[model samples]
Target: MGRLGVPPLPNHALATRLADAYRAGTTVVLAAGDVPESLDAAEAIQDAWMASLGTSHAYKLGATIPAVREALNLPRSFYAPVPDDRLFRDGAAVPMAIARQTGVECEYAFRLARDLLPGPDALGEDEIAAAFDAILPAIEIPGTRYGRLAEYGGAALVADAGALGALVVGEPVTGLDPRALGAAPVRLSVDGTTVAEGSGAVMDGGAFGPIHAFVNRARARGRTLRAGEVVVTGSCTGYEVVARGPTIAAHFEALGRSVSLRFAP
Candidate 1:
């Protein structure tokens, strides 16, 4: 749905259009591909885009403590695929794998809205607040973009062919208090049983700092950070690799909301 039907635009072009639409106070979302061929292309595209955008890259957490990391035995690196915009508009399934080295865990963070905020960059708090008015509750689907820690460094890993995962836009979290909103406990359940837990504290003690930093990094590049853009600062907790054939739910405790997801083989 971009550029007057020009082959639906390449993944990179589609991503730019999604950001542009968000800046224009319009919402846009897309789907993601799990196929290795498509995954490789998507990751390549995102690495180039992030580099061009100069956005800061970081992983989400499942919880706030080291104890959780010990429990999951997460690896330092992960595999990720570039997601379509629709997934951002609606909740989507995310697949992840644990690494044998680095022992780093990964988690998913739900960030809605297409608005951007002010930071050391040009926009100020009041301006940002005003722009955020049209924000929506878009979900951020994060997974292992990179294969493993031994495979590459964080930046390199993300730049690699397999580092980007699906990014979708889902239901808009209404009445999200930008000022009052910060980090808190986030929970996830599978078949009514808790499978993952995380906290907002992982995002630089709260959502503001890290989210701002992320946007600022993006702004540093050629792209302009607009208002009404919602971004999930990063994972409050690390990654939680789920098993096959199960129903999953992610809850943002601080906000008192939850999203249900169905996974496919």
Candidate 2:
């Protein structure tokens, strides 16, 4: 490949690369592009095509809803988190006000316990705020940029919502303690070497805020947050890519087990 500035490959070629990756069950991270100024129809073409596959979306950007809109074809589709989906976990969500960029680094995100907004039935503001308080945690990861200093924001709110699929991790906790919840230590390894280590506590304001925001957005669009939805808050640690044979593993210490995923060409 030429320099990053070189013209992008033809759409067919790009689609082939994405399709192959998806078929292999390997995760492919894409930068949700900035819009109007950087809005390339070709990029959206690729994104739309990818949604047909099993790829998932992440809202890493924190505050930039418009940018997220441009990156993901939101107005064109509705987003609801379902089982077997994944995104970047363990890192903080980026705000929407800045102009920063990051390369496609691989990361694994956690899914929320329920679908934020389901169907076309939306809710009022008061109802939404209470929902936010109900789902989010209180800890934060304290940072704005990733390893490459790319300005990340809440990408979930802006990306193609239908692309998400949550993995069925046993069952949801019902009578669990919320106030005294401790950060679960999760060990992440790349290529068999521990590159990043983090915990559930790494998420800012716990996981509820994002859920609330997501639900509110959906409700605004006349959607309802349904049960059994998946929401990956952010990355505990920034993304780390694997060029050759890298195997990524994550062990949620609280779960007393580990899961491994690999990147392949």
Candidate 3:
């Protein structure tokens, strides 16, 4: 038994069950009070989930903004793996049947041009920016294989792969100005009505802050932040639930790039 008398599941069995739930497009709740309590346990579940997915294409940052932390009651930020199969380009059609309860979040994404090697010290914001070759507008669609996300704690959410459904990446923008980018406005709309909006400043450490933090955390876990992998930083606009009938779009005002997804009934 672990914290709160929640017995930990064997890594392989937990991963297999999670993967099955995802593939079957069904919800699977843990036993009452069975959530993992430590980051290590949560991360082990995360690793198992990622391994089950096979290929890792991108990373998603969670609780990067104060609002998110407050809403989820998390003390700090966390990272989750985004598998390649869940990534889609702009204007992709998302099947609502696959993701029953979907929400959208506007975000900034960066793709590294060079490998970020692990070191004793954490990478600074400027160094993190320099490592990226391009910046892009992104919209993250979050879904859960649970009945209600609020019922689960932060560690449980982490083990559930951050509730990430799919990432819609827009066209890459080059020659970005850091200062200007950090102040950029982002908006999310459902069926032409704007539901949520904010700026890069909404993130606790600014636009590049999450990237810096993710790298350091990964390195600390004996993992390397590889090149050619996309990093979807924290959302500028908070998560807004989108109904099945509407078209959802996220616009990056300064970058002049937008990504849209339509849910098919």
Candidate 4:
């Protein structure tokens, strides 16, 4: 039942190539015949790729916004597990080589306090925050090895591990009021010039919708979110692809949490 198209499951050769490209901080432009054509085949390859790397950090969601879903023609949100080396701390710099090739997104993120259980309804804001030990303002650079992005669609992205280029995690918010996150303002800037701005209210039912969607879907696949793993919702401000010289920044109104990353050229 899991086979969607017909390439075969756990494509180890593809997984190895992806793992190598990701660790080298570069992307691969796949050919038409190379793209994963189905969600089942794509996700299976991703699973195998994750196993090949042995890296753990977080899970990221994409296409959470209704407009984005419609635009991408996605049936549901997409998920990818991030590797530790690709994640950065606040105030650091993304190596210029990679920064020049990708874009950045401002997002609301959280770390789980315990394992997550699959559920039917959306978790209330306070209840959702209660399940977490930290709230983070983040910048996600969704990178993909399959370079011609518009051609492949969701299946290709799922195979490329949600196209996660890199992530810059902001300082943790110490006293966030989850109840207020629905209206929390998020901003993204380049060299201190505001490029895009939006609030958490834009997500389906506040920012937690992605997490709930991820949890239910993941559990159905026999996976459960564990403590200490981070979950990043889709971008508040759509991702901005820029050049290598300027500083990229993100800020969230959750107790003034922010992330500032310089690009080293």
Per-residue CA lDDT of model 1 for 1-265, tens digit only, reads 0011112213556445433432343433333342213323433444444343333222222212434334433322222223232133344554332111111122333332344432335555444444444222223433332334213333233333222333433344555655455555666667889766666555444544444334444443334443333444444445565554575566665555655554444
Tens digits of per-residue lDDT, candidate 3, 84-151, equal 87888888888765667677788888888888765557777777778888888898888776776655
Arrange candidates by TM-score, descending.
3, 4, 1, 2
For all candidates, the clash counts are 62, 49, 0, 3
The better-scoring model by lDDT among 2 and 4 is 4
lDDT of 2 by residue, 1-265 (tens): 0112223433444345444543443434445442112223333333444446553332332322333344544333223332133332232232211112211221223333445544445555455433322222211112212222222322322222222222212222333432223466656666577766665454334433344455544445433444433344444444443343354455555444455533332
133-221, model 4: which lDDT tens digit per residue? 77888888777776545457777777888776778887776465543588777888888898899887777777876775676667555
Candidate 1, which ten residues in sequence have the lowest lDDT sum?
Answer: 1-10
Residue 42 shift from truth in candidate 3, angstroms? 0.9
Give stretches of model 2 more than 4 Å off. Answer: 1-34, 37-181
TM-score (all chains, Cα) for each model: 0.55, 0.44, 0.89, 0.85
Whole-model lDDT values for every prediction: 0.39, 0.36, 0.77, 0.74
lDDT of 3: 0.77
